[model samples]
Target chain A: MAYIKLDREKCKGCMLCISVCPKGQLKEDKGLNKKGIRPVRFLDKDCSGCAFCAIICPDCCIEVYK
Target chain B: MKKIFGRTRSLRGVDTHYCQGCGHGVVHRLIAEVIDELNIREITIGVTPVGCAVVAYDYWDFDCVESAHGRGLAVATAIKRLQPDKIVFTYQGDGDLAAIGTAETIHAANRGENLTVVFINNTVYGMTGGQMAPTTLIGQKTATSPLGRNEKTEGYPLRISELLAQLQGVYSVERSSTDSVQGILKTKNAIKAAFKNQMENKGFSLVEVLSACPTYWVLSPVESLDWIKNTMSKVFPPGRIK
Candidate 1:
């Protein structure tokens, strides 16, 4: 099993991670974060453990585990 | 589950002030990761430039010095010489390295300063509100070049990696980008190589990273990355130059 945790407060909502995720597990959340930006949420589906999203996250908000 | 990725200890547990989708944050993380992996955080010193990443020291947990605009290499050279056992590096932007500090960078490389230089070439001066930098592509529009950069007037984009590679004192030179997953990985590896070269007593290593400036470019973060891939890479191709 693969899992990724996101620090929503640190997320800038750039969505770069969403674009790079091979598993399409991330999506933009409708709720605003502390910074008043829409944060991304993981779909909690079958993650491939590629870690592409974590790698591309400029804010360093994501941590990946496999 | 095994932890595959997390923030490195070399970086402070604080969020960076970089704008949304900025490449500086990604580059910072990569450097921090490299420092942790190499176990050199305690002996590493970073020189921060006067551009967008001017306050890079605030995010990095290691010792850092602030340099005057474009004088990053000069300060870094002094630091490396005085403390030969330390791993010194300069994090400079396109405007700081290729324009105001060009002479310092060239002289440092020519003298083989035995330091690492992480050059962020984002085409425009991102911090000062999108001014045309020395690396700005021809026909690209910036605040200073509102009418678009003309070849006859602007001359051409300065390819710093290629120019520095020509110096005999330079040990290694590589150009990488932050446009894609592979490109980001390559950039991290290039940074690691530069740091390793310094540790191995190899003289002057420069890794020029073609980064994105979404706010300055008047494009979305993703679009700016695409521009770097499809447009900027054509002029500053990613690869080893020396």
Candidate 2:
């Protein structure tokens, strides 16, 4: 279980998370958040859980369990 | 006359008392501009040291605190802890940061308290009349080291950015100079990053702005820039350290 999660409702879809992710674990999904920003999606096996993306996010929307 | 994004309102437009070619003026304007762009002027608490930048609080319109010869870090540390929500920073010159206040700065960054430090690295001490500073380049002449600083006894100048970046609490660290326009932009970005990190509660951030002292260095304003490029930058190359 990767310690990564993003609240789709709150995600602004700025792609900053995807951009900042050291290990390309996140991508924009088919859906949009309430603010019309693309929400991030995670493929199960690709997550290394670096958390660089989470920390660089201007909005505190990312959660990493580890 | 621009508002520094509204952060410079604290300045009263009085002609500064600094010498003609001193770099302190440029350093002050840069800080004010950054504070304005971030819109953190009201919430920013800046500590001015006793060096040439001692009058910084006067030109900057914010809650300016005065620290003793080497106690800037201690005072800033206390303020940041109490007002966690406020943006606390310290503006200090080489004489204040590298010389007298070395321990205070080291320990504060070592502990990684949430604060910003805008360090001015003019090779010579500007306030006390061009005395030798901790960052004085080797073979450089100053009031004390008139014979050109001999590394044999005076010791090598301390590269502050590299040293501070070694600490765990330091989230951002960069060294830039005002000797050129490109360098100025780099310094502005570094300063922004320091404040941004502090805003997000990341930890301590230090930006060392390589400055010049023309009058005391016995060079014209243009010559001072040349001195910084040819001499100072060789020892402490400007770039992001951490």
What is each candidate's DockQ, to 2 decimals? 0.91, 0.01
The DockQ score of candidate 2 comes to 0.01
* Model 2: number of backbone collisions: 2
Q: Which lDDT value does model 2 have at A1?
A: 47
In candidate 2, list every pair of residues with a backbone clash. Answer: A13-A38, B10-B61
In order, the Cα lDDT scores of the candidates are 0.93, 0.77
- What is the C-alpha lDDT profile of model 1 across B55-87, one tens digit per residue? 999999999999999999999988888899999
DockQ winner: 1
Q: Model 1 chain B — which ten-residue stretch has the worst lDDT?
A: B10-19
Candidate No. with top TM-score: 1
| A1-66: candidate 2 lDDT, tens digit per residue | 455766666555545456556578788899766666567787656666666555433233556654
